[model samples]
Target: MVLSVHEKVKSERLYKAFDLMAAKDLDAAETELHAGLSDAEAQEDKVLAALFYSSLGVLYKIKKEFPKAWKFYEKAEKLLPEDPALKLISARLLIDVFGQFDTAIRRCQKVLEISRSDPPFLHQANVTMGLALLKKGERTKAVSCLVDAMQDDFEGLLSASNIDLKLVEALLRKRSGLEECRAYLEKALRFAESKQEERHVELFRRLIEAFPTEEATDVKIQM
Candidate 1:
């Protein structure tokens, strides 16, 4: 679809804002987001408005401003009802920031039901659901969801290795799945190596060290 002049400009600003956020320039990012929102509203583009609102929500979430994030997420949802990606992000915010485990689980499940072909979103949904379940003290179900998430490649998302490491750490805390955790750590280590993520590689190495001596020796041999 060919975007109108206004849409093209709005899109550019949104991308700029994302870049600024990644650079840790929150003030500049917020400025660009508000500017994009203005352009979107002037163009009467609900989709663009929803995108800016969602971006704002993400920005505030990263800043640890839960109330502001929630407000923007609500605005985005109101603009674009049943948007799977936005819903997944909102669910994550609810779980991580707001401590709304049950609501996050339901929202994530809804996204999972609708987004069968989208592996990245599916991975996010399952990971969010797992975190929520863990928060709710449903460790068994949480492990199931985390395992399901790890089964997917989750290509194009940089956090895949971190998510895998998180699952391994969660399993380690449970202390009953050392073998399975080792497998996941191995996968995460490979992913980290592929991405040249030295920190994550070291993190996986440390986690592996926590395994039983024999198992750790075996894993080292396998590596």
Candidate 2:
């Protein structure tokens, strides 16, 4: 249908913009997004407009234009007030880049309240909340949130190499639970094996190797 075609075009445009952004062709990326935004406005398609706005936010964030990014993100949020995805992304930026831990936690709580039915959303929300709590010196509650995040999408988390890599490092550094971290990496290795992802397999292998093994003194012989 016409709508599907429009969506496809919009999606392709968005991807192309992001690809350019990744390549550091900032001007071209901005041009692409702006053109798409104009088209969305011409169509009176607020959803697509919001999509471009959010993308602009990401682009500006990459350019280290925090205020511009925040403006675009807020514009998108206003257009789609109940959007948990926007909250998730904005929360991440607020906490990691802006160091607005309290605001990020508030946004994460909103995501938890609204995105319970979506496991990925809930999982990310929990992880973000955990990170925010950790920043606020609440380790116990942070660990609890991280545990909930792990439970929410263990398989999905394991499958994502970069995400899982950073998360595993964080867990190890924070000592969220060393046993759990090792076990998680073990499962990630298995997932890599199943998918025949050689890079992931090797990465997980090295990570698991980096973990300290059981000490000989901890073992006792039975008479």
Candidate 3:
């Protein structure tokens, strides 16, 4: 009975810490989560303990303390190896903060192997992999991965407005001087049905415009 009561208290504290973090009260969140971790340790709750470390990692990442972030993330991963979300997040943080692109790509690949049907995680994994690949000058592989992810159902992504595959393709095209993919820009524009879609489409339009205009508009038109 005492142990259960203690666990409940720790759980509540952990949630409160998470709320504080969401509210951007980093200091308060850290205090509360650390307190929860202390209680969880006393109760020998491995799962809750892992959650605490993962929560701290997120906080540290937000604070731009990458080393501290990964420290806790590693602990959490050791405790919960099956958590694809945590693994994905850790890989992203590593890529973003430490420029460990190769490691990030490898981690994301592992996520892809296990998360074939999980759209959201798969999207994250692919995005991270694409960005990492881009950093390594592997533009073709990057675009292939990113395009596959963008072609997936948007309902699984965080913001339907944010998946700008056309921009990535444009970037790759411009770097490689590949004018053949200009049709993809038009297709992306056609796909833009909503206001958010239109905004992203406009961005892609600008990118395509930046690409050197071959001949003139009259050449393509049959007036």
Once fitted onto the true fold, the runs of candidate 3 whose alpha carbons sit more than 4 angstroms away are: 1-74, 152-159, 162-174, 177-188, 194-223
Residue-wise C-alpha lDDT for candidate 1, range 41-149, written one tens digit per residue: 9999877788789778888988999999899978987997876765765565566545778878988888888877766667767877887887788878877886677
Q: Tens-digit lDDT track for model 2 on 1-223? A: 0111122233567768867876889889999999989888898877778778977887898789999999998888899788776576666656664566887899889988987666666767877887778778777777677667667335544344423233345555665556665676676677778767898788778767667543311211111
Tell me, by lDDT, which candidate is best.
1
| lDDT scores in order | 0.70, 0.68, 0.63
Q: Lowest summed lDDT over 10 consecutive residues: which window, candidate 2?
A: 1-10
RMSD for all candidates, in order, please: 9.4, 9.6, 11.2
lDDT of 3 by residue, 1-223 (tens): 0111122233788768767866888999999988988887898877678768877887898899999989987887788777566466556545554566886788788888888877667766777787778778887887676566655344454443434443244344435324433554454444454435656667657746764444332212110
Find the candidate with the highest TM-score and give its number.
Answer: 2
The TM-score of candidate 2 is 0.56
Model 3, residue 156: C-alpha shift (Å): 5.8
TM-score of 1: 0.54
Q: Candidate 2, overall lDDT?
A: 0.68
